[model samples]
Target chain A: MSSSANHAVSYPRFLVRLLSVATDGGLQFYAWMTFLTAIALVGANAWAHQVADGMVLTHMTDHVSWGLYIANFTFGVGLAAGGVMMVIPAYLYDDHAMHDVVIFGEILAIAAIVVCIGFVGVDIGRPDRIWHMIPGVGRFNWPMSMLTWDVLVLNGYLVLNLHIVGYLLYHRFTGRKPNKRWYMPFVMASIVWAISIHTVTAFLYAGLGGRPFWNSALLAPRFLASAFVSGPAFIVLLLLAMRWLSDLKIGAGPIRTLVSILRVTTVVNLFMLASEVFVEFYTGGSHTAAAQYLFFGLEGHNDLVPWMWTSIVFNVVAAGIFLTRKGIEDNRFLVAACVLTFMGVWIEKGMGLIIPGFIPSTLHEIVEYAPSLVEWKVTAGIWALGGLVLTVGVKCGVAVLSGHERLVKG
Target chain B: MSDSADGVSRRTLLKAAGATLGAAAFAQALAPLASWAEGMSSEDFLATHYKELDAEGLKTALKRIEEDTKKKTGVDVHVTADAPIPGVKFGYALNLSICIGCRKCAEACHEENNHDRKTNNSYIRVFEMDKGSIDFAKGTVDYAHPVPQPDKFYMPVQCQQCDNAPCVSVCPVEATWKEADGIVVVDYDWCIGCRYCEAACPYHARRFNWQAPEVPAKEINPDQGYLSNRLRPQGVMEKCHFCLHRTRKGKLPACLEACPTGARVFGNLLDPDSEIRWVLANKRVFVLKEELGTKPSFFYFFDE
Candidate 1:
């Protein structure tokens, strides 16, 4: 408001403000960041060991070539897609209160993308040769390979969300009303792009006709349904945290809208799950070997049976909570339902989905997979790194939106 | 840039110290990757894809590979990148009735292709199946009985070199492809080792180099092919290429030559009189997973 004549310094000062906000946190924040840094370093060490030795360190084999890394990568994509839930409500449905907290969801998307990329980077046998997929510089078999499509949609969604969040935050920091034209086009694109990111990820598996467990027409819709559930589940938690930690005046309306979205999505996700389970069990063919190994014991090997059942139970319980009046009226029950849904989807969409696709493999040889210690360490480290990114991003947004940090008229 | 009256504040000094220590620790954690990258020359790292390489570039790559192999294993292997012969399409057929579950073909492939000795890796997997059924689920590859067990039939599987190959289509980079002679080959250097091709193949034909191959200096196969049996780098995909190194040079495949019962046949499908063509004409042959529509060059038949 005071810098009408100094338009040139506005951008430079905005960058300074954005960069310096991380430094303004208190001792508690610094300790949290330090702890995350330590875990991230441990993960880096594990990854370096994996790189030096090769992918043999992972539990993956020629039979089960993808394991925990791909599982987490799939879940991370769903979480990233979850960001668009807020955008659809705030912009598409014209929910004015949701507009206030949409940036946090976008920030969460950015962090989830970082996690997805990290998992993929660690999963590949040749991380150094990743440049071979570059479009012009390398031979990228596009339009045919589902992996290439995943790479494109993931990176595109990341950029789309980044632009929307960046433009809005920069304007807020400069004390200017964001021109709708600047971010609205991107906001709309991100809604579609969000759906694409998860759809392409599902296609990456579903397109593999050899793995009959994943080769279903219902896979894409299930992915979208679960994404809507997990994304809103997470945003509610983020809003509750913001309410507790800061003075961001998040009203009850956004939470109510997100809960309503969850009400439909959680049931839809479970219904799809039921449909998938019914088809696999009732058919009882050679193609149902993976599903047999997943739901019940197959040839005395049932590694995923317990995990799959737990996920189903959690999803059903969470759905029960969301479908009830107490879920909306009681804060404690709401938090529990959110956590259960989040973890339930993590299991269902991750290990519950990816691992079974590899078990009883293409040749009908039942070679099972379980993540090793190094894999777990690397997975944890990536999550910590994501936590760091999300924390720093949200803190900066909170600082700017609260009018506590801005450009100084020197 | 926070400073107190007495030069620098204690808090600022502590923050700087913490930052430097954190940076040092992070570097230590990633030191292994730095050293691993240092072993690869810039030429190998930055080399263009094999198809994109000109004649001179191909020669340079072959020479560099030979030199690297010699330096690492003290073996002077001759690696060739022979082009496919014109008007020739390779086909392979195995007579299931005459085939014994001896695994000699798999052993020959392992030795000829310079596979990792520790894993005893081979492209050919011979499954011993029930007499009246072709169900692969009932077939066991780890059967330890004598050759041609009384009531069992042996069926060996390898890369089918499919006309509509799922592996070729699924590769994000064109690292693996179908060559002119109907042989599916992989350029190990160009493959990113995502193993998507391994998952896509219904035959389970593809194999990934999970670790650096450990063949002894003397045991290393002196004869190699850039697209076939050359010493593969760690962390890439490889599979049966019909022994293209020898086959392209008018020599028979190692597996075929090693077969004692003459159950294996390999020849140009375009040539009507070739043994493979005769097998296709005279025998009731079938390709696995015909429903998937992967038209395989490799076929299996029964004497009946």
Candidate 2:
């Protein structure tokens, strides 16, 4: 379309049109992509070092076997699950304003799930051995291992979401009406599947009875509450960024609706945290040792004290901001609240939740952990990869929806 | 699919799908070689599940372990993959009255099992407690004294080898399992090193290999079992198997032999006349965390 000679030779013009959008990045887009790609390469290099030198290079030890890698993995799962918040309201209620933005949620989910899988890949010691975890090809002890269930559900959700998104977009690009029968059921299933992914991940921790810090029945509920809070908050930030940068027509209606949802979820998340805290402190059981390490210093290992407190403060302040009508109306205040909420949940759910479960390990040994530089680099890289994927996906999505790209009828 | 110069074609989508699937399948076909280059041999990469191994496959695995040990440690190790003896479920009972907190059993297990020297990992942990309490928080494993204090009692905890093991049930890959003789054994090579079993074990009996174990060439225990005392690879889980190599061949476990007080008893529970059965009959014996219903073969009692 831009050049006459190349346009004349096009056979697969729908794909060509999608490819053109990615290729037609202005200076700003190219710079953003280049920066993301460069950082992603650094992450790849660090991963190479980890693969060569073994996990000893990581901040994790036998005492704290799952570290930042698993932390990010858990967070990534919640992030992916958050997409359903948008889906539930938009499709179920037939809120056309929100429906216009639902595709963004799906795209965000696709990005989050990809990052989740990447984190798992970097976390495992032997990347090549992953094939063994696949069903039928190797021994997958389903109904036995919670991790096996996690693998199944995460992948199943990925495929399910992929189908839903691909079906809608493919129809939109081709100018054909989507068959509601085929895609609507999947959209509904994805809502449940999204919640299930986070619940199962929580169970992955909770099922381990030995780690009393994680053995609580409240964990799954807490995961859902926090996931709903942080997930929507992140979507707000992304939607804001998209609106500012591009002509995405995401009006204030969806943002306010998302904020209201965030408000309720954040309140529940904080309440659950309070519930967990009161039980740990008041009961004075052996299970309190890990919780003790997280809040107060346990036997002089108080490294996480500052981080935990900061997360608590951020969460409390942000929740208050979102609860107020004025804060919801003011874009600046809303942005601050969302950022704080995102950071608060990231720390709370990741290190605050995961690390405490392992500290003062059931054997009562206190070996504190700090993620190594290499671990941070790897994490940053995965984030950059997510950014790149989302950018490319949204570019194509915007193009097809704007009618700049189309499939000619036969 | 028709050629359209002005719009997209179905042919392009099909070609891309074909190319992506072709590349993925081609890469997967060569993954065994890639895995072989990354420390696993082709044989180990292609090795079937432990339960799926037949007599011939087991024989080949045993020989490979022997060769692998020799190559890695320069120690000509005898690696045996033993099967359970039917109708002979093993049981152990510790006489708490006469036991001292020397921790020699812990040391023997460390050497016998080829644990990493840096981590100082041992399957057995001896806790010294005040006479009146069974509370583990009040117990100390790192006592600097030479012998048990006069008023103190010793309790050595290891894998309970539960009849219904939570660790076995939690393993996503079936890398660990309980044999008929009540020994919970881990297939070290097959384990994904997820440490879910370590987290699942109530007794904290499991140890994860953060690095490939380094046993000094001269000190390496040449007697090894494929699922028990063999030198383990990095990122896998290892634990006590009651010294299955020696016990399956009618010898006492290294920990039991190392106990200077002779407070440890090992026997087949199926034999009503065995010493463990007698301990169960005569003494007030109890298994650790029995409320969890793990049904441990290991028991503790006092002679008082």
Instruction: Pick the lDDT winner.
Output: 1
Candidate 1 has a TM-score of 0.97
lDDT of 2: 0.84
lDDT of 1: 0.90
Q: Name the docking class for model 2.
A: acceptable
Segments in model 1 whose C-alpha atoms lie over 4 Å from true places: A1-7, A408-410, B1-13
Q: First chain of model 2: TM-score?
A: 0.95
- Against the correct fold, how does model 2 do in TM-score? 0.91
What lDDT score is found at residue A172 in candidate 2? 78
Candidate that scores best on DockQ: 1
Give per-residue lDDT, candidate 1, residue B192. Answer: 91
Give Cα distance to truth, residue A391, candidate 1, Å.
0.5
| Candidate 1's iRMSD | 1.0
